[model samples]
Target chain A: MPLPSSIAALTAALSKLPGIGPRSAERIALHLVQSESGAVSQLADAIVAARVKVHLCTTCGALTEISPCEICASPRRDASLVCVVERPVDILSVDKGGTFHGKFHVLGGKISPLDGVEPEDLRIAELEARLQAEPIQELIIALGTDVEGDATSYYLAKRLARAGLKITRIAHGLPAGTGLEFADELTLSRALEGRRELS
Target chain B: MPLPSSIAALTAALSKLPGIGPRSAERIALHLVQSESGAVSQLADAIVAARVKVHLCTTCGALTEISPCEICASPRRDASLVCVVERPVDILSVDKGGTFHGKFHVLGGKISPLDGVEPEDLRIAELEARLQAEPIQELIIALGTDVEGDATSYYLAKRLARAGLKITRIAHGLPAGTGLEFADELTLSRALEGRRELS
Candidate 1:
């Protein structure tokens, strides 16, 4: 039998989320209906509250409740060493990795030529505008090893080059805690070429 | 860096669901926050609507918008035979299987001695009351092949047996579409013991 209309609506809405599939959506919908009203209300309130309160950080394009976001507004994070990423969500990954002590710039998306994503479609202009105003000494391109990512990084490095400004890309190699045997040939090549001399 | 307070709160709430992990929760929270306000509001509305509209079926304890539930009130289904299951959610699984055109009784839970669950803790009284009122000729126990499930099935069969009422447990064996090579020994043994002779 078909689920009741309201439960079906909940399942439909939940299945539209990033990782949830149809079966998972149904399970979650059923579970939610069975749960306490207070819990369900809290979940609903959280979704609504987050949507109402959160927005892109005006300065860096990261998600934030405030205009500048905590990273850009903070005094301890290195303002002169900025990491550039392809999407707003990537900002969270790098920050949560606990090693990057710099601010971030979200490019919104890569310049995928096949997908018609051009340089102008990205937030490169905003980065340039930030450069003109801020004291960023270096730009770390943390986009991945895809063709569009590489092209975007190179395009940014060339377009944003200035006197006393250094631009670098994150390393491509076998991931940490993984073996060399499973590393793809392209990644192995990149790892070999980007090898550094241990002091 | 930690997520913004609102996003963190949303992530915490989502991770409490059945299959969502902390990483998945964080990913979903980020995606939801970045999504369009209208889409987010629709999802919130769906959750709230489901919570507000749905409730347990007064008769069989299934999740439903109305008290009797669709199956319990349906005229086409066979009301003479009743199926018993552990939880209200199990009713959905059985009904959706497209077989066994019978009424249903939710036992609420199995008889688990280790977990301190007795017959009194279940909805056996309700099932008995329904038996007295309804013309239930057979009671199909669709609980699983677990030890507690078997114990509960046997207990119900003994307790509810009468001059005309027939109590039957669903089969246990290698699941359909599965090979015997991967089937555990107990499942294989059960399949062997329960084998039927084709005419």
Candidate 2:
């Protein structure tokens, strides 16, 4: 016989999660059913709690339990510098390095005309508002170097251009700790062009 | 700032699931938090409902929504034959083939002396009780071909030996659609030894 209908339903719901396919969904569902009841209940509760409690920061658009988020409210962070990213999750990737103490803004998505995404569809207007209200002196666009990323960065640099505000995109070069053989053609060329002579 | 405490909790809970590591768990947590509120709540509800509703069939220890399970209650199944599996989930794997109309019994685990899983720890007593009460004539041991599986199968065969009762194990050979070259030494030897004279 097939799995019990309830287990099947659990598997279907789990399959909706990112990175979990039908086979893995089935395995996890079966495992969860036979696991400790308390652990299963706790997992369910955690899902609901995260969904109900987490919200985007009003100022920076980063995920947070509070309105302004810890980064936006922190006086220790560099308020004059704002790092812009494509998705909210990118904030976590950059912050994990613990080097960037600047504020952040999630652009929601890059300008992908092929997929019908436009600048207006992103959170660009909100970013402009933040720049006007805050003392932001520099905008670090930490986006991919793909076609969409390049187009979006170019458009933003031109549109948000002003007398004082400086705009720059993250460097596109060979990743650290990777061998030269692993670097793709485009990455090698970019690394060559972005080279600087140490005095 | 790091992820909100609620999101962190959700990521931790997700990481505990099988096949999900820290990176994928964080990705899923972020996706779920951004997904529609209705879908997230439905997923949470499905997990709790499945965990609360589904249970092990008391008769065979297979996962079921009811006491006897559909297989045990059905009249169309072959009541005179039973398939013994290592875990409740293994029942699904065998039954999915649709050729096994016989009932099933989950041994909970195989006998592994190295792991301290003795015969007494498994559901052998329950199988014995079923055999005594039911009119079963054959017991098909659907288990892996690992060292533990072979030992358990041999032990069960010797222990359950009786007049008018037959105990057998599933075949060990090259899997269907696989080339002969893919078969390992042990599987090739077993297949060669079990070869029959076709008319």
Candidate 3:
């Protein structure tokens, strides 16, 4: 009457993943079942291996096979500058730009009262410890422009203001290749507020 | 400079799955790395378990935990009528209609010379063996309406004509919930040719 129990179980498990819907999960499950056993086994082994080996860097909370992560361990990186992000994945977005040569600090999540995520729930304590231990000159908050991200940024700014560090948020503006008509009012307002002199 | 070797390996492995592109694979890999170890472990275990537990039904070639599968083992189904399909997943689509109570025969794939899929490459021999063994009266070809499907259907019809069994294909027409404007010329032509008169 229904899909086989094993297939149904696999579909349910796949549906729990981000970006995977019920239909997509069912398709993937069916594909896996129909695929070669060796390929499926390899996928399973890869997942398990990644889960077992990858872990959050103790120094910056970024995902890494090593405790400190390569970024934290690299002496060439600017230790004086620390970029704070919401999750380990956010680090990849920043890293891909190849602009910043500083170290990173993953907050694990934003300060969302609705989601019951407070500042203490994040890796703020580890950040504070790093601030005290490292000669950090600036803290760049590279968080989302949402309400939660704003609240978290504001909270971090206030908490770390006494530490005599230069705190700044990434400038918001019309995205590249997007016209003014496509820009939302909030983004336009932020662009106006963050306008710099082009002499 | 690049992602950790383990993370990259997981991403590559995930990308190999159907419907999962490189970007989606990367996102899933990153999510797994960030997720609780228990949850990732569960997904891995589920994949392996499904791969290990599920096998092709010996009687009909459908995926099932059992060798014969429920459909093949059940006596309630019309054993005299066999519905031929391209893949095991196609059986699910037919079964969902809840109209056909006949047994299913998965050919694994259609005849595609371009793809190097021949009749011998499919489960045609097994189907012929079933025809000789079972009290099959009629065979319904429920394959896709593609060129390859038509070729396969024609081939099977010729091969099985000597057996004196009635062979019919599922009709092609304008799909439900679609307007004539959306119907292709070939489909419209088929619908016109297959039109029936009201009594």
Give the alpha carbon lDDT tens digit for every residue of A1-199 in model 3.
Answer: 4799989999999999878999999999999987899999889989988888999899998888987899999999999999999988889899999999999999989999899987789999999899999999999999999999999999999998855699999999989998999999999999999999999
Q: State the RMSD for candidate 1.
A: 1.9
| Candidate 1 lDDT tens digits, B1-199 | 6778999999999998889999899889988998899999999999989988998777887778987888899999899989999988898889878887888888888999889999999999999999999988999998878999989999999999998998998988889898889999999999999999999
What is candidate 2's lDDT per residue for A55-148, written digit by digit as tens?
8888888999998899999999999999999988899899999999999999989999889998899999999999899999999999989888
Count of clashing residue pairs in every prediction: 0, 0, 0
Q: Per-residue error at A102 for model 1, in Å?
A: 2.1
- CAPRI class of candidate 3: medium
Local error of candidate 3 at A12, Å? 0.6
Kindly report which residue pairs in candidate 3 clash with one another. none
What is the DockQ for all candidates, taken in turn?
0.78, 0.81, 0.79
Candidate 1 lDDT over residue span A1-199, tens digit each:
5788999999999999989999999999989988999999999999889888989888999988988888899999999999999888888789878999999999999998789998999999999998999999999999977888888888898999999999999988879899989898999999999899999
Candidate 2 residues lying further than 4 Å off, grouped into runs, are A113-116, A177-189, B179-182
How does chain B score by TM in each prediction?
Answer: 0.96, 0.96, 0.95
Error of 3 at B12 (Å): 0.4
- The better-scoring model by TM-score among 1 and 3 is 3
Best by DockQ: 2
Please state the i-RMS of candidate 2.
0.7
Against the true structure, what is each candidate's TM-score? 0.94, 0.93, 0.96
**Chain A TM-score for each candidate, in the given order?**
0.96, 0.97, 0.95
Model 3 Cα lDDT, one tens digit per residue, B1-199: 5788888999999998778899999999988987888898889989988888888899899989987899998899999999999999999999999999999999999999999998899999999999999999999998999899999999999898755699999999999999999999999999999998999
Q: For candidate 3, give the lDDT of residue A49.
A: 89
